[model samples]
Target: MDRIKEKMNSLRVEADESAAKVEDLQKQVKTLEQENLQKEHEITSLTHKNSQLESEVETLEAKVKDLKTAADDGTGHLTQNEALQRRLQLLEEEAEEADKNLRETNDKLRQTDVKAGHFERKVQALEQDRDQWESKYEEMSKKYSTVQKELEDFQAEIGNI
Candidate 1:
């Protein structure tokens, strides 16, 4: 009887530990989900900025093409040609910088995606663990209740003696 009581006590302790672990896992899952949401938002913002940069580059390229055509025609003054060249150089530099930024953003997005995937998998695993622990806790609770009832009946019989 004492051994049975000790077993019940141990099971109760194990159940409490399992409950704590489940709670901790739930918190971790929530945190990961929030981080995933933030990363998604960042990706959306970066994509929008990339599109704007692409449009600007296209417009600048068109202007450069027009300037090239004007320079081809001997009618433009030398000073005008020099000014156009300077403007084209500046535009090209800006376009190059924009492209570099876009590439960096894309890389960051990819890394974020990977991290999100990893977190999702981890959450799934933790959820599975929590479920298993819950099942174990239920089983232990049932056993504990049964053992407690048996102990009560045994004590009652002893008291009658």
Candidate 2:
């Protein structure tokens, strides 16, 4: 009876150790899950911002093209009005302003694309980092399980002894 009691006590100790290891692993898994969620949200927000900037660039390019067409029309040869020259000068200025706006928009679009790509790379890096953590967790979990099995075997042997 004393031997049986000692065996039971040993089994209890082994069980407690296994429980603690499982709890630690669970905490680590929870932390990794939260980090993954945050990275996904940031990538989504940046993608939406890049899409809006692309639309704005397209609109600005269309407006610039319209201005260029108006300036190139042969109104100087067809009209005898002295104001035709002034109208041409104003149109030229408007076209120049439109050109400036188009270039600025294009630059902004390029920058947004670059930033989006950078964010994408960041996300990939994070995923790789997470993958490494996951592999480590798996390995540790396996080791913990093996230790638990060993404890059970030792407890069984103690009972036989």
Candidate 3:
């Protein structure tokens, strides 16, 4: 009976050790499962962030294309502005030339007016001299007629005596 009790006690101790080892292994398995769940959640978050970044890249590319088109339009506008400035400069020069021509014409007209005024004054003086000469000629003709009549009367007187 004593030997049987000793064998039963030893078997009970071995059984207890085996149960403790199984419990430790179960705890390690549960910790590994928690770590795997955390890793899966991190992978899901990184995938969402990557998708958002790709979408942002596409949007930035579209914005760059629009900016290029706007730049092209601005270049055309600048060219048109340059052409307008050239035309305006030409018009300004033409206007200046016309003004110079007008000034010269005005100067010539002033000279012609002065010459016409001088000629009119000379014509007035000539008309006055012509009237005086005509009056002197009429006086000389009347005196000649009076002298002829006196000569004829003297001849008749001589014949009567």
Candidate 3 RMSD computed on C-alpha atoms after optimal superposition onto the true structure: 6.5
Comparing 1 and 2 by lDDT, which wins? 1
lDDT of 1 by residue, 1-161 (tens): 88988999888898888889889998999998999999999999999999999999999999999988887774557767898999999999999999999999999999999999999999999999999999999999999999999999999999999
Best model per lDDT: 1
Evaluate model 3: give its TM-score: 0.56
lDDT of 3: 0.84
Give RMSD (Å) of candidate 2 vs. truth: 71.1
**lDDT by residue for model 2 (98-144), tens:** 99999999999999999999999999999999999999999999999
- Candidate 3: which pairs clash? none
How do all models score by TM-score? 0.48, 0.42, 0.56
For all candidates in order, the CA lDDT equals 0.93, 0.88, 0.84
Is 2 or 3 the stronger prediction by TM-score?
A: 3
Candidate 3 at residue 39, lDDT? 85
- What are the runs in model 1 whose C-alpha is more than 4 Å off? 1-77
